[model samples]
Target: MTTPRIVVIGAGLGGTIAAYEINGAVGNRAEILMISDSDTYSFVPSNPWVAVRWREPEAIQVHLPPIFAKKRIGFTSAGAKRIHPAEKRVDLNNGESVNYDYLVIATGPDLAFDEIEGFGPNGGHTVSVCHTSHASEAADAFEEFCKNPGPIVVGAAQGASCYGPAYEFALILDTELKRRKIRDKVPMTFVTAEPYIGHLGLDGVGDTKTLLESELRNRHIKWITNARVTSFEAGMAHVEEVADDGSVKSKHDLPFGYSMLLPAFRGVPAVRDIEGLTNPRGFILVDKHQRNPKFPEIFALGVCVAIPPTGPTPVPVGVPKTGFMIESMVTAIAENFVEILDGKEPTHEATWNAVCLADFGDGGVAFVAQPQIPPRNLNWSASGKWVHLAKIGFEKYFLRKVRKGESEPFYEKLALHVMGIRKLKM
Candidate 1:
């Protein structure tokens, strides 16, 4: 019998964990190879901390080559230039092609900062925590800004899916300014595309609206919801606030000395424009089993997968795929592949829930959304200093798991079990 070859693209969290799980499930029966653009894996959740200089970049990054070698998994830091699903081949940028019996694409998102004028870390009027390197740069900028505090603008741009980081950064910035005793000198304003505060692309999870609104108010962070940022100049941001009927209600020219806006995300070019495999925005479309409908041999995980917005707002808002939810997708893909190896059709489905932990500098908030939509089995959110500590614990635990090449840790299982939470119903 021919040995099955499995190729996983992008060594982000989803891709790495998928490779680990596949190795454990198939053992020596299959060949597992991982391809990524970079040899280092950075814990993205720690980026906000990095931005504030609370954590260093190196503390959150793990070199991939050594870890993959320890697990005896094939590794290539060179990225994929193109994927020919029809030919079952992935062309590497370094001039090589790898063919596979099955492929898992967890390439993550491509920041669409170019969508807005003067809006990204790269030669833009704003700083970003979207990448570790970006966070490092932001930290330097933040230090300089503290010397002469001015009006600050922080929020997510229109069509941005991940709003948690924006909210967290806003609160974290508030906390940081307070610590420096310069908050009184800095006027902060939040601008977002959500129809209201705390919508979070899932349409407000468990009193999230009231909770987040109160939190923002207590921190003195004024907000403008249903607002679209048209562009940004050196010291000014142009915003247009819209009503529910989709008409412009007001416009404002806000001034700022420092700003950080989460840009929109789209599918990376490698998978973008692929017929039937991706949506208009380049995110991979998958079935309930996490397998592409056009090609069962191909599957997608993480932010690269397409998830529709819960409801339409004045400005477009994409739904975010949280960390735990990505793990569920990874698990489902692994289980389905195991079934295939057993000569059975894939039957497993990811629970597709949302479990997010957003930390401020001092305290944090956490929410759980079973099925990731409204009218769910479990919908809850709470905030406290414990959540902040828990977030730190999660980062350390996640990095350790990557080092050990562990797909799922025992403690994580225990916690989720105690919480009556699971990856899938089965």
Candidate 2:
């Protein structure tokens, strides 16, 4: 009998770790292959620091080809052009196709910058930290902005699922400017689609509403919530403040010498627009076991998986797929694969808990939300200088794991156990 093939698409944080954990679980029972656009893996959470020149790009990157070879996993960087789920094949950009017995879609998000005019780093007025390359370019722009600092604007756009980085970059910029003594000249404005400062798409974890709002006020940063960015000019941003009734309350043209706005995300083209496979937004639809209902052999995790909003808001907001939550999904999928190989039903479920550390250059905010949504068992948030330190430690530890080809190391599992944090549901 031919060995079953397992293909994992994308090699970001979730995909890379998923490959490792799944390999550990299934052992030699199945052939494992990873398809990624690049052979380098970047620590995405540290992109904000890269933008401020706090860390070099190479420092946080891992060369994946060596790691995969050492782990005895097949790898390619040809990238996927399309996924033919019905045929169990993925067409590559390099004019090749790979057939799989089971596939894991972890393509992450496709930044929807084209939806808004003059947005994003690509041929756009503003910059981005969504990618390590973008962050490097942003660092150059920051140096230029400092030469003649003026008004600065930062926030997340409508349908932006990840808000922690926006908040982190905004404060990191603040911290950097203060250190340079240019903060006095750089008037800052934070604009977001969220109804309030700390909604964070999960409806304000713990007292985040108060914690984030107070931080902004203390930093002398002005804010505009329920904001929809209409467009961007060379030196200005057109924004509309919406009322609770979904009407425009006010309009403003905020001038900026430098701006960074997080764009909305959708499923990548490779797996999008397929009936019964994805939602209208192109995010893969998965069951409780992280398996597609129409295609049980297909499992998905990370930002590519479709998740509903916690509730409704004046503007569109998406629930964030944080690090802890993605880890849980990875664990559940790996366990389910083991069950399937054993001729048993796949029954594992991820906890989907959220644990985030939003670092400013000097201080930061931390939050924990069990179940990651509303009306949870535990919802807590805090802030201090220790968070900044913890974030640095996390970045180093995670990069080390990638370099060493280790997932869920003993120390990590022990720490989570002590903190009562778990990846799988009981």
Candidate 3:
């Protein structure tokens, strides 16, 4: 009897974590093949550091082959074109086909700059941190701006889920400009789709609103909240005031010499057309176990999940799937995959899950949500240099674990338990 082959699309956090866990068999009857469009996975969380020249993409990215080879995992670096889920075959960009017994569709979000005028695909008039190349360009743009100081604006546009980056870029730029001794010359403004500072989709996780607002005031960084950016012309950002009901009732314009507004995200093109496999917005809809709702043999995790709002905030709101939240999904997918293959039942309860990470730039801030977004218990957050150091520690640990094919059962269990707690169930 031949070993069953598992084909996983996308090599992002969720996809990579799944491959890491499933590469070794549950009981030695399966082989895992991880396919990705890129040879190396980018640490999207620190992409702002790349934008500000604190980190370089090449310094951060590691090749996918050696790690896969270590785990006896097969690897393919090609674009996934289509999936025949029922037939267990996936079409590749090279016109090749691979068959599998099980499939995990972890194709992460496609940064849709096109959603906002003057950004994405053709490249934004301003730089971005959404991709390594974008970050590199942002660094170059920063250098040019430093050589000739001018006004700067940074934030997220309408419909952006990852609002943390907006805050990160703003504070980081403040630090960078001050270091270059041009902070006073440049008029800095923090523009965001968030109804207010620190309302990072999780609804002001752990005094985030207070910390962020206080920091902005201390740094003398100006901010405009509840504003939806309309477009970017030569040197000005067109924006508008949004109604509490989340509608564009009024409009205005602002100017900038340097700006980095995170664009909206949508489902990747390859997974978009798969019938009944995705939500209307193209996000993969998953159950608590991270299994695709429409296809049991398929699973998804990370920014790919379609999570509706738990409540409303000041600006247009979307749920955030930060680092730890994604890791929880990875763990759930891994354990459940084992259960499904072993003919045993698996249960993953997602209730009170929180993301605990330090947001870097001006020192850093840490957030812990008892429950996700809002309606929490013990939502304590703080900022300091130690938080920044801890972030580095985490990056090192994550890279080592993935490279070594090791999963800490303790960490995984802690995440699940936290989620269970947040859900308010025993």
Candidate 4:
């Protein structure tokens, strides 16, 4: 019998963890290969720290080749130029192709800053923390702005699904300014597309609205919700506030000396626009089992997968696929793939719960939205200084786990078990 070749795309957080867990599950029964655009793994959750120069890029990045090789997994830094799912092959940017018996797409989202006029870090009006390079550029811009503090705008743009980073950066920025003794001089405004202050794309988990609102209030950060940012130029942001009935409530010309806006995200071009595989916005469509319905051999996890808006609001608010949810998907895929290799039907399904930890510099907020939708099994939110410390510990533990090429270590399981968080409820 031929050794079944399994190819996993994108070595980001989900992909790296999936590769490690899959290797552990399947052992040497199948050959594993990982393809990524870069040979490094970055802890994306720490990008806000990078933006504020609290953490350097190298501190959060791990080289992938050596790590994968140590685990006896194949590695390719060349990105996929095109994915021919019908032919079960991925054409590489370097004129090579990889054939796989099973494929996992964890390629993550492609930031859609181009959707807005004069947005993003490049020759644009605002900065971003979506990528390491972008975060590094944002650090420089942040330092310059600190030297001459003025009005600052920090939030997520229209069509942006991930609200955590926007909230995080705003609070972190506030903390940094207070530390610099310029909090009195620099006025900050948060502008988001969510219908309410703490909607978070899942319609406000627990008392999130109250918890986050109080935090913003205590920090003296004013906000605008249900806001559609039409464009930006130099120091101005054009915003349109919409009512619940889908009518324009008001329009405003907001001024800012420094801005950082998280843009909308879509699937990467390689597998995007594929028939029966991706949605119109280029996000991969997968079944409850994490497998593409049209292509049973294909599975996707992380931001690349398409999830609908929680409900109908005046403006669309896409649901966020939090890091914990993605890890659950990875575990599900690994377990089911092992079943497939055993000549049995795959039965594992990811629980898809969302556990988010959003840290400010000194304090933070966290929420658990079981199943990541309304009417959840568990809906809770809380805030404390320990959340900030927990986030720091999580970053360190995740980085160490990646470097060691282990998916779920004993201590990790023990901690989560104690916290009552399960990767998947068996």
The numbered model that scores best in lDDT is 2
TM-score of each: 0.96, 0.97, 0.91, 0.97
Q: What is the lDDT, from 0 to 100, of the residue 147 in candidate 2?
A: 99
- Across 40-60, the per-residue lDDT of candidate 1 in tens digits comes to 999998999999999999999
- Show the lowest summed lDDT stretch of 10 residues, model 4: 409-418
Q: lDDT: which is higher, 1 or 3?
A: 1
Full-model lDDT, candidate 2: 0.92
RMSD of each: 2.0, 2.0, 3.4, 1.9
Better of 1 and 2 by lDDT: 2
Ranking by lDDT: 2, 4, 1, 3
**Model 3 TM-score, all chains together:** 0.91
Quickly count the clashes in candidate 1.
0
lDDT of 4 at 115: 87
- Per-residue lDDT over 325-386 for candidate 2, one digit per residue giving the tens place of the 0 to 100 score: 89889999999999999999999998888878889889988888877888898887888997
**Candidate 1 regions with alpha-carbon error over 4 angstroms:** 409-426
TM for candidate 1 is: 0.96
lDDT per residue for candidate 4 within 22-110, as digits (tens), equals 99999999999999999989999999999999999999999999989999999999998899999999999999999999999999998
Regions more than 4 Å wrong, model 4:
409-426
- Judged by lDDT relative to the true structure, which candidate is superior, 2 or 3? 2
